[model samples]
Target: SNSALDEIVHRIITAGLTDAKGETYIPSIVRVGVNAHHSISSVSMDSLVALRVESSDRAKGKRRLEKDRARIAILDESSIVASTLAFSGCSMFSRMTRTFDVVVVDEAAQAVEPSTMVPLCHGCQQLFLVGDPIQLPATVLSDRAKDHGYDHSLFKRFQTAGYPVSVLNVQYRMHPAIRSFPSREFYDEGLEDGPNVVADTERPWHKHACYGPFAWLDVRGKEFTPEGSGSKANRDEAEAALALVKDLMVRFTELREPGLMAVISPYKEQVRLVKSLFRDKLGAEIAQGIDVNTIDGFQGREKLVAIFSGVRADDKKGIGFVRDERRMNVGLTRGRSTMIVLGSARVLRKAGPWRRLVRDAKARRALFPFTRPFDKSIARLTSDTYKVEDEVYSEEGEDEEWEDDEDDEQDVDYGAESEPEGDWIPRAEPGMSDDYSDSGRA
Candidate 1:
């Protein structure tokens, strides 16, 4: 949607003109989404980090000082710099401003507290506030607004907030399978009529296989495992996910630096587990970009092989993975080639407000265009296929030969049990397409 939306906007303004005679679309939407419901220029990342610390502060409290100084082993430079919101001797608020060609605020309703934007919108003018107010507003301002010296109701704030606001009446992001949920939960004005939003219920569940080599790990078995008992049962899931990653290494010999895989968990400690595992096995992994979290992790990056290890099942249990629906979706869609969900969906339901309105089967059918299987007659990590050209191959000096298997191994097998790289498949290997090659790095 990001690229396509930009392309459409460009086309709309320029009449879709290019160097060619006919109209064509070009995506020129350069965007930088500085994380927050608040204004980008008004806020700073350090301010947000400090806000997190301030949120845990007590109205009347001070730290009890221990007489004995703890052992200080200086690894990196240790210092307390001025926070973005607080101007200290080491820092200035104006120096930390981030600039972008195009700036837009997503989910503006959630940014009710103007204080969050006070440090960000110091110079922001070009801004776009986007979201549905029917759902929810910012928690900070919504709660204890009188104490913050504000008396405006949320409805009034919604009516008068922002400058030059526009509504995205046309819904486009959701798959048709689950649009109804958002319609009920979010869309107050509802969707504008359009053919782009269509349904295809005819596709069978098995017909729409997931993006390969996708695998869903079940950690539901460890839902009731006792934690903080000094045992590693809680840590077992992280360890198992690491084991799967190692299995991938042994299974795929051609796994290059970029192909080693990543582990994504909503939890930071689980991410630490992945880093430690990589350190214990391979050296300090530079490419193991798995710990990209719900907070500032994988917006501008992707991995070819993603192993999502931390799937939290128990909502009340505290260590469960899925903390937010949007965060889970971000993790789910991060895979460029393959997305391996290495945890149980059952376990994450324990987190309250877990509403899976659309079953995965239905959602996939509505999203993907082609539900066809990968061509069997392909070879290598390259996703190419032989067209069954003449049912024979006589290239080079070799004699013409039919693809019919030998008298013994005549049965073609392309089952799930078979390794995709192996030549024991039902079809013979094909010539590589220009875009594809012997290596599966792409």
Candidate 2:
């Protein structure tokens, strides 16, 4: 969302505003400034020093305040000023004597109403709130505070009051296959794919059936919670996920790059376990290249490929946080090229949206039952050895070789501790090919 805000600012500075058609009006030259936290100040725009207002001495504090005011005065000269929500309400901004003509809050659906009010209080005549209420809401830690509706956002409030909200119907991030189910289930089939992300714009990995635009590997993994821990982890799902990643890396050379792929889970314990397993099996350097995070933390982020591990498998537990449709929407829509979900279909089918998801995958012929050990099964599917190429070195004018443990001949068993019943595993649809070369267009 910060990127979206930054893009908006950049467009305003470069091309001013444009109409729906291709017409653009170049406005008179105007200065624009952005104020943000020091950590995120390295944005596309020029960075400014974050004002520090704390001081122990009265004289020093007065001088600091005066200097900060001078800095704020520089921003006041700009017709357009952008700042983070917290920075907009800082002491230095409060001391400024200028008011804005318009205030735009990006990601308003994820900000609490009180926090959203901070920028509006700067005497802006018109306001615009930009966000999707269907994705995720503001997070409230206290149960009591949540009961008092502290998590309700101003964007949702306006929508609830029957405001005329304009919907942006075309999405450019996800492939058409990856966007289909979420569009139909969440947006009442109103969302459409942009021209750039259609089936013709397929990535190289799309040639492999298993690495198609969308697929769900039915991992009948059992979930377990550790002692003194509230989060859950599934060893089977993690192994399957790792095996998928390994296969992708070996098959496609581009996937080896960092930040191109991500492995997300709903539980912190599962994220920790997946990271550890990746380090152990893939080695620390390769593992460090992948992004592993919780589903909540991965919101508003996209990757070339995404592997989601649904860690809740017990029927009695009834799918835990996976049942939250908002979180599900965010998790399902994060992949730009490919989206692979590993979970127990039996348990996920108990929830309404998940049931529809599973049914949709089956109907699209993208659902595969993962019943065998990942190493052997993936090897059979891809017909490729699960080994990384070794590096050669010539040190001190002598020919030498560098060997990696991952390239060793030792066979490691990365399977579930217990197998599920045969009835729980669904057979692949008729005419489905096990060959990776087959295009599995969903």
Candidate 3:
């Protein structure tokens, strides 16, 4: 839906609009919304469009909206009016005396009930709430608030209450190999790969077994929490992930573009560590090409390649939020052509879904060990003449095969008490506002 909106906005900005009488003219569009800190008022509108930014100075914005009413009325008649949920309920829009024939909320399941209610307050004959309740819910921090159902989204409430839901079963985002496990494990095998995805989702790297559509690198690394930090990170895992990313970019020139690859972790600290490592090892300009984010931050987004760093390797502490099935689903489904998961099999195998994921990877011949001298292991796989049937080399190019004998061991039932080692915090970089939201959601 966002893609469709982006295309519409691009057309209006570049080629203007054509009316029924073969006349074309530029149209006036206004985007009214603010990000978490009110720093970014316009979400994605072009500079040509008027912006009514919501901020502390509400009267000024209201006056600006009033002056733009004629243009707004023209947009209402010929095009769509776009506004954030919070801004839609602001007094500026209420004073416009405009109602819509239809209203559609994208990613509605990520918004709390009250937030979803904002845009609906405006009169609309038809309403569409587009979201998946099975993914991450609203990010409510207070346990007391959650107990009172503050985190439950209106979309989830409706789905749980047996309201009619239209399932968009056809997914065009992931390669079939990458989509198989999640579809069977989470969606009851109801999800189908689009024809286009099946034909076009294969990448040049897929020729190597290690870089196929789906794979899991067993990183038996130790996880540690930094002093005064409320999250966990695994240096070994971060290095291994970085190595894989570098190998891919070096071997394939087409994959060296920004936003083509992403690194996702369940822990904020892991994300921070990976980003720091990327900048230090790959340099600032080149590192900027790859996105590093937390699992919840990467929802509703996709890339050509995704590297997942599961920072929990402690058998006693269990897997932390990495055990959340919904979060795992989001991480696994984000890569369009390649999904490589880096984790400790000994730790991940304790959870049900994760154990199945590792087992599935092994069954598909996509499991590999992140041995010492990790760079060489990566190089072996990315070599121009490397063949998939090269006997599966490990450290020093020694022959090795991944074993899963421990998969049958008794499973541990970790309770909710086994929470993460540190409290979750919003990611912040130097010279950036602490409240800056990078989740790419309104």
Candidate 4:
């Protein structure tokens, strides 16, 4: 997960920073984000984890490390080069008076007030801090830190200070149906679909029309706790989500583009379980293409379909992390066309935000009760491909098998892809095209 951000910086530097001749044009680009590792063994370009430029010799080679440090110190305003570094990376050169034309902070809401101000102190003419305050906030764990206002981000503070702010109204991701609720609830009905986008109400992709755009499969009675993870895993929910994936694949078999989908959970353990289920039921190719991650993972990204698995079912525990409204906003707004949510409605209704969402869903008839078990016939095509396991939990030692080596960290970068704007989204660096738009991080 930590390497996810690193991987994005790598891609942006490698793929996005090219000139008209299709060559690396930037005189220099530096990445200062702090992540656990530089490279990921089984990294996906769509991963939610973050990447950082390591300056420590123990982390990277001496030659490369020195090069990175030098990139931050370079203050050539005349040269058409870009430097990417973390706030701390800039702090390393505090003794030297360095300045630039502009400084763009990608996830401004995730940066605390002080750190965000460091880059602004440089004599920059224009400042662009892009982030959605309604989504995830800066990760502040300690109570002492909260008391000191470490949880308050500079973006939110700036917005509250009556700074000139522009909200992007048109979103290119989720189907209008799925986007409607979050747009109404969080954005004051500011989000709209792109002009070229046509969201079908009925099943244009399926021969037999089915309920669309939004679907809720209630798995109230079918969740259980796994042995060692100390987290709940719902076999019924997992099976149902996989079955939905199968149905989508078969229904949209003729589509030109790959069926983009995601299975999102609020917990890493549930993420692992869903990923395992996807692989075991579907296969490797399908699993790789479909992102399985936490709500934070889908931040700043959108997909054609999003299947949310609310893993917590215990009435007493009160739905755990899903109770947070900000997280719900991120989870609900990730899909561009369809959002199929699997959870215990009875349990979710206990939370105020989810209750309002459930109420809205019921009023719209987007809610579908999980009265019957998963339809085996719905997956007849995939039945021959792989056998569905009856057991919920993975075997001993198998749980650890799927665990990645992202290291234990609370906050990691989850970079989202910007839709190709006839070519590429403009970078924050100088000497680049000034045209750019909000990519809708939430």
**Cα lDDT for residue 244, model 1?**
51
Per-residue lDDT of 208 in model 4: 24
- Please write out the lDDT profile of model 3 over residues 127-227, one tens digit for every residue: 89998888877767667999999989899899889999999999987899999999999999999988798777877788877887998888889999889
Candidate achieving the largest lDDT: 3
Per-residue lDDT of candidate 1, residues 220-337 (tens digit): 4343323542111235566665555554555455343332355665554455455666667655543232333321243323445555654344433444224444445446544434
Model 3 scores worst on lDDT over the 10 consecutive residues at 408-417
Instruction: Give each model's whole-structure lDDT.
Output: 0.35, 0.67, 0.69, 0.58
For model 4, the superposed segments whose C-alpha errors exceed 4 Å read 1-99, 118-123, 199-203, 206-211, 225-230, 254-259, 371-373, 377-442
Output the worst ten-in-a-row residue range by lDDT, candidate 1.
67-76
How high a TM-score does candidate 4 get?
0.66
Model 2 TM-score relative to the real fold: 0.71
Report the lDDT tens digits of candidate 2 across residue range 14-82: 444443454453322122233322223433223332333333556976766665665666555554565
Better of 1 and 3 by TM-score: 3
Taking all chains together, each candidate's TM-score versus the true structure is 0.41, 0.71, 0.75, 0.66
Candidate with best TM-score: 3
Candidate 3 versus the native: TM-score? 0.75
Error of 2 at 203 (Å): 0.6
Q: What order do you get sorting by lDDT, best first?
A: 3, 2, 4, 1
The full ranking of all candidates by TM-score, starting with the best, is: 3, 2, 4, 1
Give residue 229's error in model 2 in angstroms.
1.0
